[model samples]
Target: MKKVVLITGASSGLGKSIGEFLHEKGYTVYGTSRNPDKITDSVFRLLQLEVRDVESINNAVAKLLAAEGRIDVLVNNAGVGILGPLEEIPTDEIRNNFETNLFGPIEVMKAVLPQMRIQKSGLIINITSIAGYMGLPYRSVYSASKGALEYVTEALRMEVKPFGIEVTNVAPGEFATNIAAHRYHVRVSQASPYGAYAKTIEVINSQVGGGDDPALMGGAIYKIINTPKPNIHYKVGPFLSRFSIVLKRILPDKMYEKMLMNHYKL
Candidate 1:
């Protein structure tokens, strides 16, 4: 039997790359986006979905189930990044970020788990970020969102293990995706006071360079999905993530904060 995979936020970036990679590997792929028309026909089956809306998510799954009968893999890749000081960010903006980044995946998983449980097999691959493990200067809310996702992925892994469903969280450091450019929310009012700090944020963005190639992340996701027994988490991108992991393990809380402040020049 051919494996069927459903990927969210598949209009572009890592999600689209994963969809294309999986399709090339001979899996029946269903890719979902807010604007399905934007998805290329060569990639996979494009389904209209808005992760922020529970109704849209449920409806998309219903349509997929009606057509394909089963989904073997669920890739929750739809997420938005909100970059700014925690105090400066709007309450509504924070809610919106959490809705799309955290709750969206949770709802989609809830919708799919019933069928997956009945089948006694499935894989849930969540595209988290390096920010999930460590905090950055201007990305407090975004980091928090991913941190919540990391925890959710951990909990879900244990919950679904008994049902023969595997959950994997792929944390990519940086990919050459428009996510940084497209998703950043800068509040000029809040930033005006921190003139030098605002300039530092720009420098950090320039250094990150939109991340590594999206294809690298695509390959990593492909490997995880294809593995006979996937691990709980797969970290991709440059060696910097490894360094951060080591630092996280070895450094004290205050010291770690100091180190990060120095490294980013924040």
Candidate 2:
């Protein structure tokens, strides 16, 4: 049977790419957006879903189950990026990032798990970030939010294993997505103490503009879905980004920090 897949935040960017790719590969793909009526060119079905709202999450899940009767895969790809100095970022904004990047995905997973468990098979893939593996300048909140979801996947995967559910995190490095345009930025004044912080945004944007293809993430997700035993985490990006995680594993604490500082020109 063709697997049924539900992908959130699929209005555009990586989520849209993944959804389109899977649709071509013959999976039944349902992509979600706050306003599905506006996406006129989607190759697959689009559902109206707002991850921040629990009712929206449940309704979308319930609707999909009603149509398909079983959901085989879920891509928790709905997330927003936050930028600027940590100290300058407001507490409420930080919480909001956690809400969308962390809590929202959790709620979507919760809504799908019962039906998945009943079927005795399902896969949950959380779209995380390479930045989640490290603390980068001006992206402290984004990193922390994605990083928390990574940890949640670690524990949740083990807990759900007995019922045949597989949970994993897919961390993508900078991709040429409009994530930059949509990010929640903490505007710093010209005389802010964190002078280097403002300048780093340029470098970050340049990298993302020149980043790897977003379809690569789709390919990565497709492969993981086919694998008999998908690992806890799958990273898709430029070699340096993926290797940075390795460097973090072996390099001394301060040395790794220094490398990042130098990379960001901080």
Candidate 3:
């Protein structure tokens, strides 16, 4: 029997790449996006879904279940990134980020667990970020969201292991994607005094211009899906990402802060 894989946030970026790769590998792939009308992929079936909405999730799951009868893999790739100083970023924007990045995946997991439990076999892959393991200057809220997701992935892995269900978290560092292009709802105020960091912020945003390719992340996802026993967390990207994770673990807090300040020339 062919396995069925459902991927959210499949309109573009790593999610779209994973959908295409898995579909070619013989899995029945269902790619989801908020603007379903925009998704006209002949490679995989596209379903309309917004991970932040419960009703949207339920409807998408019903449509897939009715057609496929079972879901073997659930890829929760829907997320948003909001970058700015913590004090400057609006509280509502932070809440919205959590809704889409952390709670959204938890909602999808809830909607799919019943079916996976009944089947006694399944895999859940959550697309987190290397930011989940370490913090950065202007991405406080985004980092917190991914950190919460990492915790959820760890808890779910142990909770569902007895049922023969596998949970994997994919943490990719600075991938080339339109996430920075379509950065939703970033409000900057000239009234604020922290304007000195404006140029630094611009430089950081510009660096996102030539990050790692999204295809590499897609290939990493493919490998994790096919591995006999995948690790709880898989980090993808350049060597610097690995080094950053290690530095976070070993470096003193003040020294780490100084290092980041110097690296960004802040």
Candidate 4:
């Protein structure tokens, strides 16, 4: 039987790329967006789902199972990006980022585990970030949120091993997407303490626009889905982006910190 795959936040960006790629490979693909009514051009079915809301998550899963009977793969790609100095970012924004980036994926996993356990096989790919591997200067919360999910993937994968469910994280460094436009950016002020943060934001947006194509992530996801035993962590992006993670492991803490500071020109 063709596998049934569900991807959250698939209205656009990397999520849409994955859905389209998997659909072409003959899988039954269902993607979710907060407002499905507005998304009409996707190759796969689009359902209404809000990661921040448990009711919306449960409802979307129920509708999928009722229609497809089994959900073999899930891509928890629903997340938000937050950019600003830690001290300047509002507490509520931090909480909201966790709600979408960390808690959201966990709840989706909870909703799917029962069915996956019954089927005796399933795969979950949580879209994290390379920044999660190391704390970025101004994007501390974004790093923390993605970093927390990485650990969640580590813990949940082991816990669900006996039930035949596989959970893993795929951290994408940067991709050519409209993510720059959607990020929760705290408006910079001329007199703010972290005035340099405005420059950091500009650098970030420039990199995002120049990042690897989303199709590359789609290709990477396809390979992971077909693997009999997927690793706990995978990353997709340009060479420098992926290499940065390796450097962090081998470089001294202060040296790595200096490199980051110099790169962001902080």
Candidate 5:
């Protein structure tokens, strides 16, 4: 029997790429999108899933379980991003960020765990960010959201290990995707002191525009799933971004912060 794979936020970007690539590899791939109409892949089944909505999540999972006897891989690629100074950002927006990026995945994991536990085999991959490794300027909330998710994945890996369930956090450094269009910019006043950093937006945008192809990410994930035993964390992206994870570990606190600032030209 073919392995069953379900990916959230599969309308486009890395999620869509992964779905399409895995489908080509002969996995039974089911993808979820907030606007089901946005999923254009003919080979992949699109399920209506608004990760922020509990009912939508439950219904989607139920439908998948009904159609497929089991889901071998669950990729939590559904996430939203916010950009701005933490102090100026709205509380509701912060909550919205966490709701989609953190809580949404947690809820989905809860819904799938029982079935996975009973089967004694499953792989859960959470798509986090390099920002999680080091909080970036003007993207504090985005970094915090991913950081928290990574921490949760750490604990979850241990908890699920005994049941033959594998949990991995795949942190992509940067990719050329529609993520720029989805990033919410916190409204900042002209009088705000932090307004000077507004130029960082363009810098970040340029970085993303030149980032690596997401097809590479799909290949990385494919290899991960096929591995007999995978590690708890994997960083997929450009060499520098992947190296940043190591640099952060060996460098002193202030030196690492300065390196990040210099990278963004802060």
Candidate 6:
């Protein structure tokens, strides 16, 4: 039987790329979007999924199982970006960010685990970011959300290992995607000292637009799922960006902060 795969936020970008690549390899791919009608991919079945909604998440999984009989792999790629100084970002906006980036995937994993446990085999991939490893200047909350998700992935691996379910966090540095368009850009007050760093926003956006191809991440995910045993964390992106992960691990906190601020020219 073809391995069944489910990917969230598959309307475009990395999620769509992953779904398309896996479908080409004969996996029965089911993808989710907030608006299924907007998913133009004919190669995979698309389902309407509002990740923040419990009913929507549970129903999507149920619908997929009804059609495919099993869900062999899940890529939790659904997430939103909130850009601004943490103090200036609205409370609701921060909550919504976590709701989508952190809680959403956890709930989805909860919904899928029973079947995965029953089968004694399954793979769960959580899409995080290099920013998660080190907090970015204006995108503090976005970093926090992804960082929290990484911790969740770490704890979850131990909990689910005995059941034969595997979990890994995929941290991508910069990728060309529509995510930049949807980012919640905060208007910094001129009087606030952080206002000077506002220009960094435009710089960040430019980097994202010129970043690595989404197909690279798709290819990485494909290899990850097929590996007999995968590492707990996989970082993908341009060489310098992926190398930052190692730098963050070895450098002192102050030195790392200096390097990060210098990179953004803050």
TM-scores of the candidates in the order shown: 0.94, 0.98, 0.95, 0.99, 0.97, 0.97
Which candidate leads the pack in TM-score?
4
Off by over 4 Å in 2: none
lDDT of 1 at 7: 94
lDDT of 3 by residue, 168-256 (tens): 99888877788877665345678876664676567667666767888787688778878878899888887787678889889999999
Q: In candidate 2, what residue range of length 10 has the lowest lDDT sum?
A: 194-203
TM-score of 5: 0.97
TM-score of 1: 0.94
Global lDDT of each candidate: 0.85, 0.94, 0.86, 0.94, 0.90, 0.91
lDDT of 5 by residue, 49-75 (tens): 998998998899899999997989999
* Better candidate number, 2 or 4, judged by TM-score: 4
Q: Write the per-residue lDDT of candidate 6 for residues 127-147, one digit (tens) a residue.
A: 999989988888889889999
In the range 1-266, model 2's lDDT, one tens digit per residue, is: 99999999999999999998999999999999999999899998999999889999999998999999999999999999999888889999999999999999999999999999999999999999999998888899999999999999999999999999999999999899999999999788988998887678888989999999999888999999999899998889999889999999999999999998998889
Candidate 5 clashing pairs? none
Candidate 6 or 4, higher lDDT: 4
lDDT of 1 at 252: 95
Per lDDT, what order, best first? 4, 2, 6, 5, 3, 1
Q: Where's the lowest-lDDT run of ten residues in candidate 3?
A: 180-189
Pairs clashing in candidate 4? none
Q: Kindly state the number of residue pairs that clash in model 1.
A: 4
Better of 1 and 3 by lDDT: 3
**Per-residue lDDT tens digits of candidate 4, residues 102-132?**
9999999999999999999999999999999
